[model samples]
Target: MVPSDFKALIQRFYQLQSERIETYRLFEEGHEAYLRTGPHYDFEHYKQLVHEITQAFSGISKEVLEIKGRLRELDQADLCEHIEKLQSKEKQKLELTAKLQLAKQQAQDHPEDEGCLEGIQEIKHEIIKNKEALSEIMQDFKYDSEECD
Candidate 1:
């Protein structure tokens, strides 16, 4: 039989996964609505939906960090280290994403500016690099988790 604390941890993990899925679904719906409505779409509402998705992911990420701390406390050092690495990669990805967004906005606001265009391109490359790094981290975590099972 599984220990109660481990079971509870698993349950919480599943719950966070479910919430992330639901949040992604809502964000997709809002995106589709915006695309369909085109120029007439309410940008604020779509932005709010995007914000909700970000908040949902942020909440899950925080929980995972806490879980990693718990695992460390329980002497599951390998798993905790994997989680820590994943979290670090995730943070880098988030930072790159924010930079990309800012660069895109600058490009949009100054379409004729060569510097702005160059900045956007550079930021896009950085974002792609960070995404690839994050993907590798995720794969490593998956392999580690599977080995544990």
Candidate 2:
């Protein structure tokens, strides 16, 4: 049987993931507008949106890391190993998120620069790749959870 605390963590993780996805969608919409219209894009609003989503991502990542640490303390070797792998992926996700934020800031600061626009596009691609990797990691975690049962 799965521990109640573990179940709770999973639920919270899902909730955070849902919020992150929605925030990402909004950011994508804003980014697409900026890409199409260039100077007409609302830089301040775009920055604010990215900043908000980044903050949310930071909070959720921190909490999930804490939960993973707790899971590691449970003394179940296989489960602990699985959590470690998940944590590693989470770290990569956080790094990608930071890169994405930096790219957005650069694009905002240098709206007229082609290099800045290209950097944003490249970083967006990296973020999407990282998200796919994260999805696979989550799937692994689910499989691990069932095996633990």
Candidate 3:
């Protein structure tokens, strides 16, 4: 029989993914406001949002990854591996997002600061490199979960 804790852990993982989708909506809203803001975009706000949620998600993912051994013991190795891959990719995207926000803040805070715009350009390139990774993973999880679908 599956342990109650395992079920709970899985539930937490899906719950986090749902929250991530809502988070994406917030990002999209901010993105669409580009060129419309009066003084500046709210990079500071998003920076804090990214930092806090990333920390929280990292903690949850750590717990989930630790439980994977038990998942394998219970013959759920495939699911365990999938989570491992998705988590790594998601981490990369989150890191770049944090960097992008910082660059935006730097540019906004000091328009005269050298390289701030270039730095954001570099981060955007990295984001474009694997932009589809998150969407692909989301689609895969969506098929299996009712959380973010």
Candidate 4:
């Protein structure tokens, strides 16, 4: 594939990866909400969503490897490092989001108390910043190559 084709492939991989990640995120959110509200919602839906997300992620993992191989600039270790970082960051984001939701619920339950809402918002802000940094890292490979041309 030409460089343009490779770039397009990379972009598509990122899009699919994002979709898969978002699916998992929704499952996480649903799980958290269920934990707070007891048996009020369809917890099974979240479980199914998680299953589907895992399947989607499995498919994308193969595609990511194939695309990276075609790009010829990334080795197995490099790809592994990126995958590890993405996975770690994603897990952290989910955990932080869950904590934020729990804190919000506590604040709601205690109307007069402001228990760690500011801290929760700050954590959320940091998560956003971390996500932006991850996005930059993902793009770094493509942009760095362009600079050589």
Better candidate number, 1 or 4, judged by TM-score: 1
Candidate 3 collision pairs: none
- Cα lDDT, all candidates: 0.67, 0.69, 0.66, 0.62
- The residue ranges of model 1 lying beyond 4 angstroms of the native Cα positions read 1-54
Task: Assess every candidate by TM-score.
Answer: 0.66, 0.64, 0.57, 0.56
TM-score for candidate 4: 0.56
Against the true structure, whose TM-score is highest? 1
Whichever of 1 and 3 has more TM-score, that candidate is 1
The sequence of per-residue lDDT tens digits that candidate 3 reaches over residues 56-142 is 666766766766666666666555676777778778877787678667767876789779999989999988875677667656654
State the lDDT at 121 in candidate 2.
Answer: 84
What's the CA RMSD for each of the models? 4.4, 4.3, 6.1, 4.7
Better of 3 and 4 by lDDT: 3
Clashes of 2: 0
lDDT of 1 by residue, 1-149 (tens): 33456556645755764675576567556666755554465678778877877887798899987887776666667767767776677677556655765565555556788898888688778867866875676566556644544
Ten contiguous residues with the weakest lDDT in model 4:
71-80
Score residue 46 of candidate 4 by CA lDDT. 52
Per-residue CA lDDT of candidate 2, range 40-89, in tens? 65677767776886787688768766766777766455555655665576
Among all candidates shown, the one with the greatest lDDT: 2
| lDDT value for model 4 | 0.62
Candidates arranged by lDDT, highest first: 2, 1, 3, 4
**Order the candidates by TM-score, highest first — what do you get?**
1, 2, 3, 4
